[model samples]
Target: MNKKILFVDDEENVLSSFKRNLRREFSITTAPGGHEGLEIIKNQGPFAVVVSDMQMPKMKGSEFLAEVKKISPDSSRILLTGYANIENAIDAVNHGSIFRFLTKPCSNEALISALHEAIRQNQLLTGEKELLEKTLKNSINVLTEILGMVNPAAFGRANRVKRYVNQIARLLKLNNIWKLDMAAMLSQIGFVTLPNHILEKVYHQEELSAKERNMLAEHPEIGAQLIKQIPRLEDVSQIIRNQNTDFSEHQKISTPLAPVQKFIVLSSQILKVVLGFDEMIFRGISKPSAMSILKRDKSKYNPKVVDLLEHVQISEKERMQKTLALAQLKSNMLTNQNIISLQGKMLVAKDTELTDPLIQRLKSYDVSVGVQQPIKIFV
Candidate 1:
């Protein structure tokens, strides 16, 4: 599409002559005054270039261009003035944010060349902004997709954890909710460093050798050190660093990292209970059985995190039993409920049987019904 240019001047002959000269090269629009130009700007936005005469009845070119700077920043601005008004034109160019200043009676060659360059600059800025945004979005998505592979069972748990963290943030009444989102996405980055054997053993509640457990525990430091180099990912990395810290005085006892690092601390504390609940369910552990284990002897979990996790597990069981019972599932099916995942798609079922080889094959891509969708609220 041809680039659009808006020209503003109060003089009838000047507007008519400029439009006649530039009409064929650009999709041109002319306005008689500053107010009319602003109205045109509101009606047809995002023009590539805007050129205004320096002297006008109500507004000077600098003031008009300054206003344009706010209203349509992407549109390149230019000033046109008599040679005697060179000082004013210079101020407009510097402070008024005009792209170029031209003396009145500009030759056709000079005017056309300036307009082309100004439009090219506008296109470059817009393109750069779009590319940066796309890259950021893609990086964040990679964080989530990787999580799905590491633990298919925790997909629902992580979502629920984020919601609770959001609530806690609201409870804390902190400004800058964006930090919360960044922390939530990045807190699990360290899990990538965990050995798959330890990850599976942890999920299945298998007793890990001391060495294996220690290796698993080191993911936070490994992930943090690995991600610290990323400029935008630093906030996420900080959260990963503190994910294993206890809630009580973890923030105070440890020398605080950065303000952005606090999000990491908060997010780390949030994920523990949710991850616990998810790992138990995915391993086919029963609610009463899980609750009994939590109550047995001395548990390693923080008291608050444990209480919250147990509450969530009990509440989920009560809700699911009621919902599934209403559906009238057969007893045998309910006893051996199975989930099938093909690629990234989820299929929840009751007692669907498959060979051990098939399960292993699907697990290779980290496929499972429980991975893509995460549970959030209790209900």
Candidate 2:
């Protein structure tokens, strides 16, 4: 229940009057001009509502509120003007996305009602955004967990690539990273469609049949289609779909991409480089050698993204390898070696993180029969 409100006007007396009248009922801040108002918004903003005068000097209320929409989009805007006309009203709505348009000499009761309504509107918008983020995050977690269960090799690569993507995204100072993170986690979801033998051969750098090569090439699109079915994941899907696209194609994209387009392209570029680096590491190449190989092909990777790899510091704690008994295993521990049963069956693959369900299932299997002891793991 944010009761914060900002009022913008050219006249000092009008601002003073608003604070004097509404001070007891609402948390109020006032600015005497649009420039000062914008400063306030940049420094101490995200107010529940913003109200402005249309006839203000230098900057009109419609213009000020329009800027407010860009800086603090969640704030509900109201155009309170004395010289209200149909054109002014239309301009305010079109530019500011105004929540309410009320002329001056408005009754105190009407003003209070409009402010309250505006606050409610802001609340609804904020709540909806929060809900969507939560739903999408939960969905991502479930999908990744399922991938880990279905294909540990793919899941392990995805987890490693996610770490690399986070490093590059942070180095670049990206504001929102959930989409990139999502793209990294689900990038190999299409691998589930391929057989384990094919994945093994690819990992070992063995020659693949033309059919196998085509199937591997189609995995990105397969993963993208699977993800596109989920609402609000279209950008992530697009990134995954373009993960294998050459950087030369990205360069050919005309200058000044739209924000959405830029996000997808940049994220896809990061994924492409990280995926390649991971593959080289998997094939037993040293970090410097793998990076050098990637850098030699300038058109294959984004220079900026590839350069960030030099700065990325892999945490020793995450890579600490140890061997423990099945009884000592805990949830969230990464397996460094495959868990084999006494009967020579592979119980779990290397690089799979243990979950509660997985732990319980293993315990049941051990009790029912027997599993190899001293399981190799990373704490």
Candidate 3:
């Protein structure tokens, strides 16, 4: 409901006249030219409507409005020009995405009407954006919840990798990183398709058969296929698909790419590095040793992302291991030793983070067939 209006023109009298006439009807701000207008937009902007004179010194309205769109896409733009510049105004409307244009000598009433319509358009755009964000969040929540229930190990691994990705993103000072976060969280979604026994073997670092290894290799593709079905997640899917790809593969793209394409490549590289690092940790590799190993395989990982690992502070609390009874276990605690049943089978893998579903499953197994206790835990 931000009905704030910004008027950009080179003439001082026109700006003064706009404030004099429209001050009572709207929240108005004026800038002398495109440069000043841009500064205003950056500092005190997201104005509901931005009206600019089509012919201005140094920067044309079309150029100014185009920059405004990049800075504040929700702000509806309007071009004001003389009748002689009608063609240019039309071009601006098409290219600059101006909401509308007003010819010279426009009546005050006509200007007011355009302002109202522009405000309405802004509201619609903002409302739609909010709705889409809410929907996307809810969708991701549902998917993660399902993953937690279907495959607790994979779900826990995804959450852990997401934390690492967040740490790396923070170290890099990345902006607007929700897409990267989403890619991290859903990177292992393909595990949902694999049998629980296969996942257990993978988590336990047990030797895999040729078939099992092949199945595991196909996971990224399966995950990508499942995720690409969702709207607006094509980039995320691509990131997931490439999460296992080597850094050398990303370097193969010699041609220039769009900004989004570059972001996807960077995101995939981050996921790849984090996933590999997490695997080493899960296998009982020390942080320093894991980093050294990653450094040794220079072509396998993005060195920049791997370098950020040195800064990520591993929690000291997770290292203090203790033994607890099966009944005493709680969520979020890391398992220091594999939980084995009385029958000599591994119930849970070492280094696995406990989730609610995992805890419930262990409790149920303990009841049906006793689990050896006390279980070793990080807490």
Candidate 4:
């Protein structure tokens, strides 16, 4: 579609004249005065440029343009004045969001050129906004994939912790869900520098020396710095930075916190539990003994967070609901491997043999599988 331009003038004759001259260049729309221009903008917005007369009857052009800036910020603003009032011109430029000022009786060539430039600027800003969104989404996906593949144990711990964290957020009524989820997922990215032996020890709740304890403390700051370089991951980086702060030292914070930060922080506690439980469960310990082991470490986690997990662990109904909602499955439908949810569910096509980990997960959950489209999931 041709670019839309809204031109406002007090005189009908002036409006008609401008349209007659420039109608071929753009899809032109005209209004008799400032109020009419605002009405037109509200009804059909997103004009490439809004050109208004500086001295109108009821509303002066500067005031009108300022209001237009509030309503449609992306639209380039231009002022049409017969004689420049220096103060009004300055206000138009600074406060009114003016892009260009044109004298009355401007040549068609000059007017066209200015409008074209305004249009180009608008397109550039739009393109930049879209490119940022695409880049952010791609980066998050790549990082999540790498995190899962690099350390399955860590990934599993993060997911469990996210559940506990989300429970806290819901109780507290926090709004930054996505940020919290991301921070929780990659909360351990900094640990990539550590030896696997130390990580395994941590998972088993082994005693650590002073130096080893110091090394573990460094992971949050290390991970935060690693992610801070990526613009879109800025919020997640902050979450990593804050996740390990002692609750006794928690302070009144002013910056807007996204949901993801809490998710990450809460997940850290949950990771401790899951790893401990996993060590036991993997070693063929009884389920009752594993629960007793978790009980022993009550002091290691926030009491409220631990209580929430106990509730979460017992609520199989809630788990099934959450899993079904996340999987986006029909009541009797099977999810293809490709349709895995953000919460992470494993799906296997009946034609393919299930891998060891995938098969273990399926049987553990005792999922109801029905025939569906095939999707190969490598990780």
Query: Which candidate has the top score in lDDT?
Result: 3
lDDT of 3 by residue, 1-379 (tens): 7879999999999999999999999999999999999999988978999999988989999999999988789999999999999999888888988899999988999999999999999999999988987898779867876776676667767877887898898888664587888988898889899987798788667899999999999999999999999988888899999999999989999999986788899899999999999888876789999999998887989998999999886543447777888888898888777678789866665666676767887888889998899988886
| Clash-forming residue pairs, model 2 | none
User: Of the candidates numbered 2 and 3, which has the greater TM-score value?
Assistant: 2
Off by over 4 Å in 4: 33-39, 57-59, 147-229, 232-379
In order, the Cα lDDT scores of the candidates are 0.63, 0.86, 0.87, 0.64
Per-model TM-score versus the true fold: 0.46, 0.83, 0.77, 0.45
Local error of candidate 4 at residue 154 (angstroms)? 11
Off by over 4 Å in 2: 1-47, 55-60, 63-73, 94-96, 105-112, 317-322, 341-353, 364-370
Best by TM-score: 2
Candidates ranked, most accurate by TM-score first: 2, 3, 1, 4
Comparing 1 with 2 on lDDT, the higher-scoring candidate is 2
Deviation of model 4 at 92, angstroms: 1.8
**Which parts of model 3 are misplaced by more than 4 Å?**
3-47, 105-116, 171-175, 315-379
When summed lDDT is taken over every stretch of 10 residues in candidate 1, the lowest stretch is 370-379
Residue 28 CA displacement from its true place in model 2, Å = 5.4
Candidate 1, overall lDDT? 0.63
Clashes of each: 3, 0, 0, 8
**Candidate 1 local lDDT, 289-378, one digit each (tens):** 664564452233345544544435222443333233212333222213324343534332222222233234334534333332221221
